[model samples]
Target: MRLWHQDLLTFLPRAQILGQHRECCALRGLGWGKKHSTIDYVFTYSVKRLVDYHQLVLREMENRGYKPDQQWYCPEYRGKNTVPWTCTLRDELDDIPDGHIYPEHDDAYREECLANLRKKGIELFP
Candidate 1:
């Protein structure tokens, strides 16, 4: 997972890692000790398209049959699930820094993220 993260950073240096979660799972049908926890990351770049990117990802996760944690999202945003997932940074800062929005990509970057997930063999279900 670390290697994958590093490679992704190398490829998308301007990407901002919004959040990540780590959980342990068995590997090769072995017991818990056989492998370490895996880290799943959430990233976004352009502030202009940040909400768009979030919507796209949530849609893909649903299409792929992956369950998203309800706690991390807002219940009443621009029409329920239409807004970006609740980002703590937004509350903390009046405006997102210019650096975070730079080196951003459009819809193409979304495809790349999905491809990376496929390569990692992440089903989230099944």
Candidate 2:
């Protein structure tokens, strides 16, 4: 676990090691991939400096049901994640008429859509 945490820290510089836990169920073989034992992890982070931050981002992510722990490790792709993950990202892009979030804006039309994707930390691929 220490090695794995070290590897993750390379990318997540601000990440702090909280703890790890074993999963209760064994993954079953499915079309997605071979089955394996699941391991759960916990992590925390804090901003280096104070700035504008909104709890709305967290709410949007939770509302969108982006459970990486369950989605990445679980063998069965069911429940709230029935659709392909790519499909979800594509759907989000549809909300952006101009399709850019970096250049922040104040337009109300883009507020809901932009906030939903940006606040939730969705990565856009070129």
Candidate 3:
């Protein structure tokens, strides 16, 4: 369960983009605060950070003509089984520097994600 570097969102294949939405939902729901090595850093920040990241995934999905359920916008919205409209206002990261929502998503992490994707036979160039 990794949040692929945001820079790669536009280039990610459909399967990966959809899977990222699911990952965000899981993390925002029961998976919140759970310790998974690949994404442990996520738990260290405010839930808003995840929400902000998920917004990027949603935008990419929309750009590709995929209609993601709007309910996922709420930080409290889990899966379809759970209730939607739990929160109307969402938090946003202020003044994101270098176009990265998270500090950990630095140049090194971006290359790491690219390498990992290459291992899976998916090559995305920035």
Cα RMSD to the true fold for all candidates: 13.0, 17.6, 2.5
- Give the clash count for model 2: 0
Clash pairs, model 3 backbone = none
Q: How does candidate 3 fare on TM-score? A: 0.86
Please provide, for model 1 over 18-107, each residue's C-alpha lDDT reduced to its tens digit, 9 standing for 90 to 100: 221111111101221233333112222222233323434344444555565543233223333244335443344334344332233334
**9: Cα error in model 3, Å:** 0.2
Model 2 residue runs over 4 Å out of place are 1-52, 67-104, 108-126
> What lDDT does candidate 3 reach at residue 39?
96
How do all models score by TM-score? Answer: 0.26, 0.16, 0.86
Clashing pairs in 1: none
RMSD score of candidate 2 (Å): 17.6
Residue 16 error, candidate 1, Å: 16
Clashes of 3: 0
Per-residue accuracy of model 3 over 1-126 as CA lDDT, tens digit each: 899999889999988999999899888777888899999999887777788899999999999999989877666676766554354436443556777888999989999999999998998864
Give a tens-digit lDDT track for model 2, residues 2-113: 1122112122211211111111111111212333222111111111000011122222334445333444332222224244323232123222224222123325433443
lDDT of each: 0.33, 0.24, 0.84
* Per-candidate total of colliding backbone pairs: 0, 0, 0
